[model samples]
Target: MTTTAAPEARPAERRTAPAAPPPVRRRRRRGDALGRTGPSKYLAHAGVWLYVLLLAAPLYYLVISAFKRNTDIFNQPFSPFTPLTFDNFGLAFSQASLGTAMLNSVYVTLGAELVTLLLAIPASYALARSKGAVGRMVERVFALGFLIPGFAALVPTVLLSISLGLFHTREFLILFLPASALPLTVILLTQAMRAVPAELEESAVLDGAGPLRVLWSVYVPLSVPTLTVVAILNFLSFWNEYFFSLVIIGPDAALRTAQVALPTLSIANAAQYGVLAAGIIITLVPAYLVYAVFADKMESAVLAGALKG
Candidate 1:
């Protein structure tokens, strides 16, 4: 301290060193050469719209024709629009027993979905949690059912129904349709259930929850989106089912479903385009209503199913 005083600090030296330069963010402006859409993007958009138009064209025709007479439909086959008439609907409902058929379809589709969910949820949960020889075999069997066409089961199902005195009845279809839909439901739900974290179940168990309680409280909540998907899919298939209804509930106006009943209108009308169009619209309503209500949830379920944690 006695030798010399320290040199006085310079103003530049006293200032803090400039803070490290902020991270450089290179933001590309829109409409820049690299930001412009590619030819492939346009082509993909074109293809998608084309496919949509192709599908929508038939539906447009169906609606327009539904209000037109058979003569008008055939005579003006390319007519893009027409005066609206509801007589065709009356004709369809009256002659086809379509009213009753609609009710029957509601019963079958709802009953089948309910039964499938009840059976599939528990079965899928068990299968997803198990990893033994028996589980593998059972899973394989369910997978095999997916590959086995419904046509193959038709005869056996009818035979069983006849034997058990359950044929030609809604009760028979309620049971049989669910059984037919079960394997696919189980497969979808089993995969979805696997997506639920095991830790949730363990935590529930520590809270003194039993297996069933844990399932209802934990895994079930997590798996709800996928379950809605299963219900919607099964509802669509069961509602549109034709062959099974045609054969199983055949010729029975009281028990027939919409698909089965609609054809009778065709046979009677020489397949009147107008009346059949009305019938088609009637047949599509339930499925469309379901999709409209659950479309967002269904899309979420699909995305969730595609990704695994």
Candidate 2:
């Protein structure tokens, strides 16, 4: 104890305090939420706007060109400020005999769509209901229809039309379009119809509902959106159909569809851009109205699905 006391108290070991942490640079968040998340969202928005511009540019140019004179169209091109005129429309109608062609297009499109739906709905229902090996085989056969290119079918189709004596007649289109559309129509509707709950179908059957009744009461109601989409797609296809109309219908004004008629204006007018554009607009009007009318069904279907989710 004396020795320890005597041992000169060793200089108190200097204890070093912990060093202060380096200051963290805090990022300023406006309203605690406006901090930059990423460049991707802004990039996506820019891409969408660019896509909009690309699509709108052609339509804008077409619309303005329809109103413009040839010289104005050539010179001003994209300018909507160019003088507008109704004369091109009149010229297009008269020169192309577009009024008659319009009527033909309506008849063909409506007829084709009706026939296609009638055949497709029943066939699709059969396919959807059947669970046999044969049914799968049949489905595969239908799928094969898609592999046959449209151009490849041209020769055989023309030959068949010639044999049937339907060549150069609009009637053949009414028949031929359905044949081409059946595969897609049947596939889509079959898939859609299959989505109907089996329990619902059983309940309906217990309530004395036959297959037809079940279809009309249950499947049809649920599949309206799909039907609308099919109708719209076929309408556009039949309306804008040119190659077959030109080939089978043989440029006959009495039988030619609107799509085929539009080109005659060019041949007759020496490529008057305004008149051609006007004809294009005229042909497009019916298609536009049809699409507008049916588009609501599609929108409702989408909203319903989102709400269910």
lDDT digits (tens) for residues 1-309 of candidate 2: 334432232221111112333233233333333236576767767798899999999888888888889898888787788887989999999988999999999999999999999999988888999999999999888877867668777778888999999999999999999887777777778888998899999999999999999989988898886787677767777888888888888888988999999888888878578998899999999977876776655443343323321
Over all chains combined, what TM-score does candidate 1 have?
Answer: 0.78
lDDT for 300 in candidate 1 is 48
**Worst ten in a row by lDDT for model 2:** 9-18
Expressed as tens digits, the lDDT of each residue in 49-154 for candidate 1 is 8999999999888888998877788888768565558999999899988999999989988888888888998999899899899998998898777666778788
RMSD of each: 14.4, 18.7
TM-score of each: 0.78, 0.78
Clashes of 1: 0
For candidate 2, list the clashing residue pairs, or say none: none
Q: Cα deviation of 147 in candidate 2 (Å)?
A: 1.4
